[model samples]
Target: MGEIRQRFTDEFKEQTVRYIQEQTKTIPQIAEELSIPAGTLQRWMSTHRKFENEPLLDREAIRQKDKQIHDQELEIEDLKEEIAILKKAMHIFSKERN
Candidate 1:
């Protein structure tokens, strides 16, 4: 009969990676404590490193969106000013015709 394989949740894997990053313990020591293979823990750390740049990407995207919103607001203000000028011109022409 084959031995059953153990499964771990993504949350558990992420927490383990974080613990490894925050501590000075050796990989073998942590693996012994957690009763998992050191290679498995190391693999998790490798995966975490790959995704770590995601936050930086997210911040850059947010900055671009904020800039877009600011530009749109300025455009709206300019349009409003143009509308006011047109209204004043209409008033002036109406009085000239009276």
Candidate 2:
């Protein structure tokens, strides 16, 4: 008899990580259930964490940036409305004079 080979996909890896994080099961327990070695699973988790890139902007930084952008957009809209009002006033005044 020949040994069978197994293939794991990206989704499988992600699901395993999620299970490890979210479930109360021990690493060995999960490994046994998945038919992987405990050490290999541990290495997989370490690799996943190590490869995760620290975002250039963290969550708080992103929130601040979004707020700044929203404020700038509001200011621009206000300026545009002011310009329209000024143009209307000038048109009315010129019409009165002529």
Candidate 3:
């Protein structure tokens, strides 16, 4: 009798790939631990290798970027308010001199 084929979900595959990437364990060791074939894990790793060189942003980094953007937006609003106030002041001064 032939062995039934096992299927894994995309989430499982992605977590497994991330684990393989982050762990110090060898592929064979991880495969054995997970009861999956080394070849399957290797194939997943190979597919992920394409984006391995790209920098992945962690949650903290993303949060910091978001804060920076928010701060910049506030600064922009403040500058716009200052510009309007300066323009109003210039108009008042010109009227007084006229």
**Alpha-carbon shift of residue 44 in model 1 (angstroms):** 0.4
Candidate 1: count of backbone clashes, pairs at least 3 residues apart or interchain: 0
List pairs with backbone clashes in candidate 1.
none
Off by over 4 Å in 2: 50-98
**Model 1 Cα lDDT, one tens digit per residue, 36-72:** 9999999988886444423333577789989999999
Query: On residues 1-98, what C-alpha lDDT tens digit does candidate 2 reach at each position?
Result: 99887777867776677667665577899889988989878877876543343343357878998999999999999999999999999998888452
TM-score of each: 0.48, 0.42, 0.49
Clash pairs, candidate 3, are none
lDDT scores for all predictions?
A: 0.83, 0.77, 0.84
Candidate 1 segments whose C-alpha is farther than 4 A from its true place: 50-98
Locate the minimum summed-lDDT window of 10 residues in model 3.
Answer: 48-57
Q: Any idea what lDDT model 3 has?
A: 0.84
Among these predictions, the greatest TM-score belongs to 3
